[model samples]
Target: MLSIRNLHASVDGTPILRGIDLEVKAGEVHAIMGPNGSGKSTFANVLAGREQCRVTQGEVHFQGHDLLAMSPEDRARAGVFLAFQYPVEIPGVSNIYFLKAALNAIRKYHGLEELDAMDFISRVKSKVEMVKMDEALIYRAVNEGFSGGEKKRNEILQMMVLEPALAILDETDSGLDIDALKTVADGVNQLRSDDRAFIVVTHYQRLLNYILPDHVHVLSNGRIVKSGGPELALELEERGYVWLNELTAGAA
Candidate 1:
């Protein structure tokens, strides 16, 4: 569903990602684990088309179309969703209203009629229940005064409601306690299907225990150093990244 060829990116004129090449097919979940400053989050920002990050080299294609050439909104309309690590608070705007506008925006992009108030309400209400979200919280403004867990839950809530084809979850498990992590993972798990794909970028292997990624990639110093199955995560957790560092240095 998504392909990256020699991808390089920079933020504020400082290079971050260096020649990243990876492919994610439909119905697959890939976990990218790396230490601090390894360009893992930069890769996610580039994929999400964040305004601050610029593509310096290489190409990114999504579903046969040029991804870097499209606007951020266009990417979202074409089934790209990023579950942010830190969700910002938008005061005075009800969460329901924000979701309606987002849902309608994508619908308009696809030449489909926008759902009326009743239809939108019914659809979102069911989705909220599926994620076990509080109905009262939906009436409140987005992320306003929500705890870390609440914010993470809200991010997954958006993912489920939008039903994007490619979901880049940038440290979705960070800051969330065990129960909250399970809640977030459950939300992501419920959305998984044969048509959707995911990239779960994180540091710890604990999150993988719940989400159970099909593939695990080790990113270090701006590139993928190794790719393996789920067991690799456990290996990393037990061994830490020290062994990976030694291996990377030996290869050089």
Candidate 2:
């Protein structure tokens, strides 16, 4: 669903992603693994069009369209969702209000009618149940006073509500407990289908145990140095990134 070629990016005059290439086809789940300073987060931020990360080279095509050419909101409306590593607390904005606005905005972009209050409530309830979250949190302010699990679950809630064609989850399992991780993974797992794809950027293989990506990639020094199946994760767990860096250095 997303194709990236020779993708190079920089922020604050320092390159973060260099000569990166990744392709995720529909119905596939791809995981990006890397240690600190590996540019994994930079890849996700660039994909989301965070203005600061200028694309010095390469292109990101979403389902064959120039993804970089679109504005952030347009990209989102066109079916790209990024579940942030740290969800911001939007004070004074009710979660229900925020989601309703987002849903209506996306609906209008697709030439679909906005859901009425009753329909919106009913629809959101079903998605809430999918994440096994409580409805009371919806009426509260977005991310305000929410627990770590609640914030993560809320991110999944947005994914379910938007039903994006390609979802980029950045370090989603970072702060969750085992139970919360399972719930989040189950919610993401349920979203898998023949028409959608996922790019899971994470640091651990534990999340992979539940999500089971079709492919796994290891990012380092702004490049994807290794690509393999799920077993690559086991390799990383056993040998660490030192060996991977040796391979890339030898290649260079």
Candidate 3:
């Protein structure tokens, strides 16, 4: 569903993603693992068309269209979703209102009619149940005053409701207990299908236990140095990125 080639990006004129390449086909999950400052998050933001992380060179085509040329909003309408590493709080906007607006906007873009209020609420509540989130929280402001787990679940809830063709999760497992992690992973697992794909960017391997990816890639110094099957993640857990220094240096 997504193809990236020799993708290079920079922020504030400082290079981050030096050279990257990957392919995410439908019905597949690809996990991106790396140490800190390896541009893992930068790669995610660039795919979501974050203006600050400028794509200085190369091309990204999503569903056969030029991805980098699209605006961030256009990316969303085209079925690209990015669950932020740090979800921001929109203090005054109720979660339900925000979600409804977002879903309807995507629907409108695809020439589908917007759901009525009752229908929207019912659908969201069902997803809330799937994520094991309190229905009451949906009426509160978006991510405002939520616990770390709640915020993460909220991100999963958004993903469930949108059903994006490509979901880019940047460190969704960063600050969760085992239970919360499993819940979040379950929500993602439930969304897997023949027509959708996921890009899971994480620093740890535990999350992979539940949301087992079809491919595991290691990013270092802003480039993907090595990629292998699911066993690669387990190898990373046991060996750590320290052993990958030579690979990174060789790439440089």
Candidate 4:
């Protein structure tokens, strides 16, 4: 569903992604694992069309369209979802209202009629139950006063509601305890489908234990140095990135 070729990006004139080439087909989940400063998050931001990260070279195509050419809002309406590492709190905007606006915007983009209040509420309530989220939390401001785990769950809740074609989860496991992590993973698993894909960016392998990616990639020095199967994550968990860094250096 997504194809990236020779992707390079910079933040404030400082290069972050050097050369990232990846192909994610429908029905696949790819895990991107790398150490600090390895450009994992930068890659995700670039895909999401975050303005701070500029693409200097390369091309990204999503469902036959020039993804990089589109604005961030366009990307979202076109079915690209990015679950942030840190979900920001919007104190005044209730979760339900924010999501209703977002969902309606996307529907309007596709020339569809907006959902009525009752229909919207029913749809959101079903998704909330699917994610095992609290009904009261949905009435509160987005992520406001929520714990780390709650914030992550809120992200998943959004994902479940949007039902994007491709979901890029940037460290959804961060700050989540084991139980919370499992809960988030369970929600993702339920959302998986033959026409949907996922790019899971994380540093540790613990999250993979639940998500079970179809492919595992090691990104280092702003590029993917290795690609392997599910066992690759286990190998990284056992050996860490030091060995991979040494291997990449030797190859260079």
Candidate 5:
């Protein structure tokens, strides 16, 4: 569903992603593991078309169209969803209103009629039940004063509501306890399907236990250095990233 080749990006004139090549097909989940400063988040931002991260060279095709050419809003409308590591709070906007507007916007982009209030509420409530989210939270301001777990669940709720084709979760496991982690992972797992894909970027392997990625990739120094199957995550857990760096150095 997504193809990236020799993708290079920079922020504030400082290079981060040197060259990234990845292909995500439908019905697959890929886990990107890396140490700090390895440009994992940068890669996700670039894919989402965040303006601060400029792509210097490369091409990204989403469903056969030029993905990098689209604006951030357009990308979101085109089914690219990024769940931020730290979800921001929009103090005054209730979550229900914000998500309804976003869902309607995407629907409108796809030439579908907007859901009226009653239908929209019914649809969102169903998803909330699926994710086991508290209905009360929907009436509150977006992410405002929510706990870390609540915020993460809120992100998944957004994903469930939008039903994006490609979901890039940037450290969604961060700051989550085991139960919270499982809850978030369960939400993601429930969304998996033959027509959707996931790119899970995380530092620890614990989250992989729940999400069960089909592929595991080690990213270092802005490039993906190794790719393997699910066992790769367990290997990384037993032997840290230093081992991968050493192996890369020896190979070089």
Candidate 6:
């Protein structure tokens, strides 16, 4: 569903992603694990078309379209979703209103009719239940007073409702307790289908235990040092990124 080749990105002319080449096929969940300053979040931001992180080199194609050439809105309309590690608070906008506007925008982009209020509410209520979110919270302003877990769950709720083709979750598991983590993971698991893909970026392997990625990649110095199956995550948890450092050094 997504193809990234020799992707290089920079912020203020300082490089973050040097050469990231990844192919995310439909229905595949790829976990990107790395230590601090390894460019995990930068890579996610780049994919999401954040303005500060400029693409210095390479190509990204989503569903055979030039993803880098598209604006952030175009990317989202094309079915690309990025769940930020820190979901921001929009004080004035009610959660339900924000969601409806976003969903309608994407639908409008694809020549589909917008969901009426009743239909949208019904659809959102089901997804809110799937994420185990409090129904009352949806009527309040978006993330204005939500707890850490609630904010994270809110991101998943957005993902579930949008039903994006490729979801880039940037440390969605960060700062979540085990219970909250399981709820979020369950929401993602429920959304998994034959044509959906996920790029899960995380610092530790604990999240992977629940989400169970099909592939695990280790990032060091902004490059993928090694990749393996799910077992690699366990190995990283046990051995840490020290071994991966050697692997990257060897490649250098």
The per-prediction tally of clashing pairs is: 0, 0, 0, 0, 0, 0
- Model 4 residue runs over 4 Å out of place are none
Query: Which candidate has the highest lDDT of all?
Result: 3
After superposition, candidate 1 runs with Cα above 4 Å error: none
What would the per-residue lDDT of candidate 1 be over residues 106-135, giving only the tens digit for each residue?
Answer: 889889999999998898888777766788
Q: Give stretches of model 2 more than 4 Å off.
A: none
Query: In lDDT terms, how accurate is model 2?
Result: 0.92
> What's the TM-score of every candidate structure?
0.96, 0.97, 0.99, 0.98, 0.97, 0.98
Model 6 residue 119 lDDT score:
99
Error of 2 at 129 (Å): 1.9
**Could you tell which candidate, 2 or 5, scores higher by TM-score?**
2
User: Candidate 5 on 81-169: residue-level lDDT in tens?
Assistant: 99998999999999999999999999999999999999999989998887677899999999999998889989999999999999999
Per-residue lDDT of candidate 2, residues 207-249 (tens digit): 9999999999999888888899999998998888888878779
Q: Candidate 5 at residue 87, lDDT?
A: 93
Residue pairs in candidate 2 whose N, alpha carbon or C atoms collide under 3 angstroms? none
- RMSD in order of candidates: 1.3, 1.0, 0.7, 1.0, 1.2, 0.8
Q: Could you tell me the TM-score of candidate 6?
A: 0.98
- After superposition, the stretches of candidate 6 with alpha carbons farther than 4 Å from their true spots are none
Query: Which ten contiguous residues of candidate 4 have the minimum total lDDT?
Result: 243-252
Candidate 6 residue 71 C-alpha distance from true site, Å: 0.8
